[model samples]
Target: MKYVEKAPHVDPVRMRHITDEALLAELGVTSIAEARPWRRPDPAWDGPATIEEADALIGAEVDFLDKGRGRSRLYGFHYLRWMTPLVHAYRETGDARYAAEWDRLFRQWYGTRDQVEGDWPGLDVIWYSLGVWARSMHVTRAMAELADEPALSDECWAMMMKTVLGGARWSAEEHDEFRHGNWQFVCAAELLHVATLFPELPEAPRWAEIGRARVLEHLELDVRADGGHHERSPGYHGMVLDAVHRVLALDPSFAEHPRVRAMHSWFASLVTSGGWIPHLQDSGVVWPAGALRRGAELGVRPEPGSHLLDASGYAIFRAGHLHTVINYGPYVGHELEPHSHHAALDFVLSGWGVPLAWEAGGPPSYDDPGYYDWYQATRGHNTILVPGEEYTEDRKAGLDLFHAGQHVDVFAGHHHGYSARHDRRIVFVRDEPSYWLVTDSIDADAVWQVHGLAPWKPHGSGYVTKNLLVVPLEAPDEVLHGNGPARIPDPATGTAEYGEIHSLGLRRADGRFTVALVPFTDDPPAVHLATVPPLASPQETSVPDHLRVAIGGIVDTVSASTWARADVREGWAADG
Candidate 1:
């Protein structure tokens, strides 16, 4: 009993399976072979106190999952990731039980996994390039980690050596099956791992050459010029960055590359004051503590500030303690853009020590009922949804104008998502009574929605997350359609009830809507709609620019002009 972690509390049901024999009885599989995919790996496995304890627990789950996960490369990759910790545990404590369990699980998985299951494909989906490449790397890593002991049996050692050799040869020779994004990077990482960790191998130098070539080439093509994963999800951004760091682990010189530097800086810029990312695509509010810390450890430090990643259409604005991110489309090419939300012009803000405004929900496990309908749908976002059409997701979105001033900063962007075009402007006031003014202009009938963080309630004329307000300027007393619950980003779980959705609908017939996103502490100021000359523009029907915000005995004007630039003032006059 050399290795034991502090968090031993497992589910009571899981705790019951304390022995391998009990696991066989529980799953009705006399041998682990019959268990096959049924006793599949859980990447989330907590190292068991003993190998016997995990056998039954692994069998307790995935009863209904075996058939569904037949071709799941993702599942196989996760299974391998779970093994590293066990190897680490054995290394730390020199515990025979931990080593024995790692050996047993490796043998069990290697023997039973990848058995063909009704597949008419080129490779078994379960163990194709992705899984095979991953398994090869894990085998190499395990061999390295266990160099000090006989943790691996002679038979297992030989089998894993064969795997590492084949994977490295595959990477070296031009089999040329197209790979991109994290997949390509992972191959590059595995090649490096094979090269540096096992340099004694005959082909290690060649593997190193190929790995470096792949890393530099794909580093340019896959990562956006503005330093984001071209796939538009911060989760994948981390994945790609992880691959980069893996290379850096073997070769410290790669840190000097401009692309690597920019990626780290961009990642750091996207992190909010709360450490969470206001991601647009398949991402959550979870703070990437480990990744950020690793990026820092790599010696490529982030240039801290607000950045307008013009290429990716990601605009980050920070003033004092408030952080806001506005996402306009053009994230990547059409196919690569699949994970991005259709909510261009959508924004999320964190201020007053909590999330004031939030996006729709996402990082969905494909298990959420609202994944497609609400989370990815255009209506699920803060942008205006046209009456008769779905916004054209393929259209190019661009930031037409941008100005960052001392007291005020404006970001104006437009897209041809709708036939007549959809334009949005966000004016952030950096001074007292800090607020963001968002105005959307669409030619035809449009419907829009707004969301505040959860546990929000009706205040004087707005919905408040703590003390921050999301109030429409049309009617000062109405919090739109009244607050309701919607899926919001969960920092811990990816989806939580922390989102209080005040879905305010304003059709063109009812006039377009202007929203005042006000952040406050202590007591919130009363927001009101003020009278101003209507500008000749698309939202001339809506008076967002006419919000006469009165805070701290001062008045600010918010209005928009159509044909000409409206005198959008960011000043506060004395409340005389």
Candidate 2:
């Protein structure tokens, strides 16, 4: 939490002056009325369409509001698209009607606050809403255009200042120093913007100072040299970068800082094939809409030599390579925040703009019976899980371990039921152009069962591939496969020869039994295993039993008591 607290060497007034002059000149506006038209425009349905089409899109958004069916709260942003055109039409045409409608909508939304009123929650939501409000405020010229009725403008300014600045205060007060490091930067950016725009406010400088310190602290702690946000979600990674860029844009001094440039470079690396990010963990809930749009606005382009999105969590840029991996160390703040979804140890991998693999994102309905089940289970992500339910029924889990570099690594957070008996680990490693993942499990007891089960039913059959060993397994039966007279080694060991072997054993915990999987590489790494109870009778079939086990790399049997480990050290590796 340490930061440089001296007054910035650069002058704030000069920075604000330059930005305002540039913005006004670029948009070709003299007064607030002149600014309105440029603030909002219709969506470009076709390439460079007429102003009429823009008007039509604006009309359509306004119509959505009239139906009384749009989003049900004064979320601020819901009014932006409609408000934009209303302001523009009033400014360009000098139409009193357009101006009135714009004022009416603004007042309606701003005056009538959240029914269950309180400051907005979540740093991202607050920042996003403030951006929208700032645009509105700038276009209206501090409500000067509403000169005939100054009270309305005054009220609008008061509401906005209070909400936005108050949001900053809340962020400063609520931050848990140990976790939520990224939020420190995000909230500070919004608060700093408020301070920059409303310099006359007595408390503005105080908030600005706090924001400055928080930004410095975040730069030192949360941001890695490679530029990855400590949490491993591609969506969140882009979000943090976007937040940083906003701060830097407001204060050019921030632009010169090494962390600022590093962040810009790192975000460019996360773009994957087809412009998709590895949709790891809860990131699949929403696409990278804001990130892409903002990056485009900033004129930050991906590097020429590399693809937009790399399979390994790194973005290449003219400066160098930036790591796009999510770092999880700073997630402690999420415990109190509303947007925190229960996903730990899950990561997305993208290459060439296509999400190569992903965690199945959340279902739309929070009220659904399977909500917790889908959100918390191992099958929800591409990470390893221990047998006998290691996840809490509510789906909450701990963030036990994390490290970042050329590759990112994360460890298990909670024991659904194995807290007393076993430990689980999943590691993702990338060697430049190629990538591999290692999943390991350690048992406090030598004798335990290891189970590898996928919740989803495999397509067209009841069989599943439990690739727990290094060598490929041979299909011996419709339900079972077996392979490997080969040696399975432990992963922690460095040697590629003298493969370590462990006996496969089974024992019951809770309602399931444990199954041990020995390593199949020379100098076998420590065994990582999970427990799976025998498939229940089909008569108890409401759950749809689709579990299968394989030895080595082949699907062999529905139930197997014995399997062998191989000695292949180059490909994918697993733990038992």
Candidate 3:
């Protein structure tokens, strides 16, 4: 816990040399100080307004800042994103009054330091507080140009250093109960970067070195070879990489690490066609600015047409011609993490300056049921779901493994609402240029039913109006439900299509049943396939397809079945 005292001040020459080398290598350029062209010129704001405009935004933020009541005050991290624009605007306008207001807000939140006590309030605030502080550094030079407040600058630096290093102490926990795995590392990395900036400050050198080592270690274990963060949320993955990139840029020692560069490439690969990241595993709304900046800095580009988004939506790897946004995976890293929700295999796609197919936004507050419930439900994501249940219980909200050339994850345990039954597996594979997802479930007891839909619709319009499919299972005593008409039976296949189904529906065709639901719309409708099993699987099973499938195995009697097939169409029809 001891920090280095009386550490030597970093030499300006050394700092510049190291910064130049890192930036040069990162951008793949011969020089470090060159300014890259802005992706878009700053939009013209109307005639400059006084502190009133700034106050209006702040007041609006305050109105929304109740414990998860509105968007602004859900968590400290959320606050940081909101605060960034304020800090930047205030710095740009050279408004001392606005700056004074910012200082007042900061003090109001953290002044007594009493609120910074537990995991929910204190640690959460600190985590985002570090981000706000880090972003403030970018505008610090701007602020310096407008004002002669050396005292304010020095005070900000000292306070940030203390807060960052202090947060690192809580990161030692290995459970989700205390910290998110990715956020923990983010805090650590940012702390190290802050420390490196002011080496002469107390404990700066020692804390920096320790934090750096810890972050690298975690990166090696958590970041997969395919560039997907192990935790499986593209949004959170981007955030973690952003923090890492900051530290790497600040310190030259990380410049040569392959993992650091690989992480960047991994993020670029996951972007969707709409300029949004794939909502894999607990992902939520996120801006593409950080990812775009990271891509530009790292010289990593997405392969042409390899992403779901168009060129503008995708981050160009090699050239500085296009703006790029990277997705940080969801959830902070922690062992047996609890913040882990049922959001397995989620992504946020963006285009231009807007997000396409964004994960539903959440406030940082934990008080609202919408925030907590959505965070824990599979309904909020673009994934497969079993009929009549949520996610599994045991492994439902924990990271499986994210290393080597493969990335594997499971959403078992409690989140599924089944304390006794277990039969579900969601797997995502990235072999470059192609992404494969497989959902397999087994039902031996036959006590449950399985179904599927194309686009995920939580509301009524998406179901009745959108192009979706509903396949029903008809056991002797079981009933089937389709969206539109009551139960229009398919005369040819003996299966019912109550609504306008774009694809084929599988009903009690033969003794065994299988259905393929394809959406005629842009993206496929979110589907859920469930089965009633008499017994649990003795082993795991694999189903290959872009669509979602789920199986409801009988309590403790179900097991998964594995089959190898070259094509998705063949695999779906092949007998096990």
Q: Write the per-residue lDDT of candidate 2 for residues 460-575, one digit (tens) a residue.
A: 21222223322111111122221211111122331112121122222222222222222222322222222245445633321112223332243211111122223211222222
Error of 2 at 155 (Å): 6.9
Sort by TM-score, top down from the best: 1, 3, 2
- Count clashes in each candidate, considering only residues at least 3 apart in sequence or on different chains: 6, 54, 100
In model 2, the worst 10-residue window by lDDT is 37-46
lDDT (10s digit) by residue, model 1, range 1-576: 001011111122111112355433433324322110112121212223444443443323222225454433335533376556666566566766565666676666556554535233454433344554567655655665564455556445434544565566666663233345666676776677667755544556777887888888777777778788777777667766767777776777888887887787777877766666764677655456666776677675775456687666788888878888888756343322267666678877787435667666563454455666677777666777776687666757777666656677677787877787777778787766678877776777677666655455667766666556766665522224535334454444433344456555555544256677788777767776444554556333533435566654667765453211233444322110
Question: In candidate 3, what are the lDDT values of residues 493-513, reduced to their tens digit?
Answer: 423233321111122212232
Q: TM-score for model 3?
A: 0.54
Preferred candidate (lDDT higher): 1 or 2: 1
Q: Candidate order by lDDT, highest to lowest?
A: 1, 3, 2
**Candidate 3: where are CA atoms >4 Å away?**
1-53, 57-82, 107-110, 115-180, 252-255, 286-293, 296-339, 343-366, 371-374, 379-391, 395-441, 444-513, 521-576
TM-score of each: 0.77, 0.49, 0.54
- List candidate 1 segments past 4 Å from native: 1-65, 69-79, 116-124, 127-129, 172-180, 289-301, 331-337, 367-369, 476-511, 533-547, 559-576
1 or 3, which is superior by lDDT? 1
Index of the highest-lDDT prediction? 1
lDDT score for candidate 3 against the true structure: 0.38
What TM-score does prediction 2 earn?
A: 0.49
